[model samples]
Target: MEKPTRLALLKEIAEFLNEETETYDMMQGALKFLIDGSDFTTGWIFFIDNEGNHGLVSDTNLPGALVKNNCQYMQEGTCWCVQAYSNEKLTKASNIINCSRINLATKAHYQETDGITHHATVPLRSGREQFGLLNVATPYTKSYSEEDLELLESVAFQIGSAIKRIWLTDQEKEAARINERNRLARDLHDSVNQMLFSVKLTAHAAKAMSKEEMSKNAFNTIETTSQQAVNEMRALIWQLKPIGLEHGLINALSSYSEMMKLNLNVQVDGLINVPSLIEENVYRILQEAINNVKKHAHTDEIYLKLSQQQNYLNIEFEDNGSGFNINHNTEHVSHGLNNMRQRVKMINGKINIQSSYEQGTKINLIIPIKVD
Candidate 1:
């Protein structure tokens, strides 16, 4: 036999790896490239799945009688490929009948009427990772030469590199998907939920107390309820107001309080600590709790307290006007109550609202210290 040109072989293998974009196409092309140019009577590409079972990734035109009679069955245990990869050794079986190195599966499948087969296989391995085996066999009772073994090893190397590149690309795509989910999760908790809470609190308070009632007690109930609605509006507005909340929650809250004062003359006292894990949702929850005081308490003077406790942080916004029952009053704005519930739950903290129709509203928050 004439010696095969090394340059031509390398060029042919490079084209095989670079030419195919899809995975199965690459497998089929690589398998056929090895079998067609030579006179291998029967051969197939062995594919190993995650569960370690082996099957034919693809098989080109081999002798019909050999494979169709299921002469060499298409599926078998993955042990051959596994051992090749695991040992990092080249496997050469001269005659399947007399070959003792290979396990029974190979003999049971490939041992034909000719008594045995000859094949050489090298693990398609790149770095320390092995994808499967590249193999070629003939139904003749003869052994493969050392030269044949060396050539197939080169082919296996090319196949392994291609498998690694394909695997890497898939991992990158999966990582991108996870990052997108994290950003969307933050947005929903901060912006969308806060606005809806304000709407609910205001509507409920308005329904419970009458616009028609003129008596002082009746009018006070309406006033307190209406004010609670306005405060929730402040909370929602603060939450929806800025993309600049990353400037720090303190600045955003202070700016919002200034804007509300011109219209309602309600002073906002805010106490805030730097947030853990991006602070965006924490800011929104605090804003919702404070506005509850402004809207429902109807106080001209609201006190803000910000302090940190070991392993926990506290934010207090209190008003000295009309306080409603934290548990019982459906009349004042509790619209954002549920929204705050969600935000705090993410960080494993809790919110407290204390007040009644005339006692004034005080909002307190206790959140865990989760430093990003």
Candidate 2:
């Protein structure tokens, strides 16, 4: 490509990156723009998280061999470029010594390579933080000239900076969300919750003072309604600002169980520190489990065991109560159980529930954890 043309393409890519907020879309669009505007016929980008897990985020014009099996080869296993980037050796744009995925494709007899044997790899980085790799390849291209490498490096820098910006923006948004939730929780607790408590107290006093049956019934009804409202407001407040979560998950659950006046037997095997997302979901699930037991299980005592393994966190809840058939109870299947399943699925975790009539219930949850 000509110098002016390359500069113009870079300008367009910068504009696209600036306007794009979604990471995957930004990367896929940038890859397409790079390949379509330059001499490169194929390109792909990889995203390496803090845990060193790599994912093929975007690609353009992949050959049949690489695209086979839904891009299995590219998605799995380490390649030369990835290893070099991970080891801090691939800081700038340079030709890969060999393409391992291509070699494997050739060995598997997927002959539609389109002469693609090597790729120019550039480490996507912004200052000190390393993101991943950006690779561009053209048919029959053995090496990239210094000027070409410089251009690739410049593009990679733009991509890396854009990614970092997006991540920071997301974090800021999340922090704002949490702050707003806490503020609302505090306001509700101070204003509406206190008012409901006062209403309950006044109604109770009025009921005791009234001598007429009709007057007593009216005051009694008012007291019951205000008490129920107070309980519901407290539940909402807990959801907004999970009690004792800042200390730990166990503390939060124990606090909730105490509020519910249920006997909670807790057993822990390992240290419990998890991401906020996981911790919140687990707390909510257990909270719901405790509520279910108190309402439907007809049991005052619950057993909970939490254990942390190398790459998985396991939690179990057992209650010996009036269990119902899982397959036959449509209400149970559709409500709380469904919500628990959705929560587990949201975090890429697994949940198992075993219950039978008069046999009690056991719930097991397994969540993957990224260890630093």
TM-score of each: 0.42, 0.68
Poorest lDDT segment (10 consecutive residues) of candidate 1: 93-102
lDDT tens per residue, model 1, 1-372: 543475566578678788665556787887776665554544566755323545567666644333543434445343444444445453432223333323343544454323334455566667865666776775553667666666677777887788777655643543454356446645654665555555556555655664555554554555566566556654444444433465766666666666556122233244445443426556667566556655765655656666765656777766678776666666435567776765554454556667767777766777767621
Candidate 2's displacement at residue 231, Å, is 2.7
> Compared to the true structure, candidate 2 yields what TM-score?
0.68
What is the lDDT of every predicted structure here?
Answer: 0.58, 0.84
Across residues 98-133, which tens digit of lDDT does each residue of candidate 2 receive?
888888976775578888888898988878978788
Clashing pairs in 2: none
Candidate 2's displacement at residue 99, Å, is 1.4
Cα lDDT for residue 335, candidate 2: 94
List candidate 2 segments past 4 Å from native: 1-4, 109-115, 211-221, 246-249, 256-372
Best by lDDT: 2
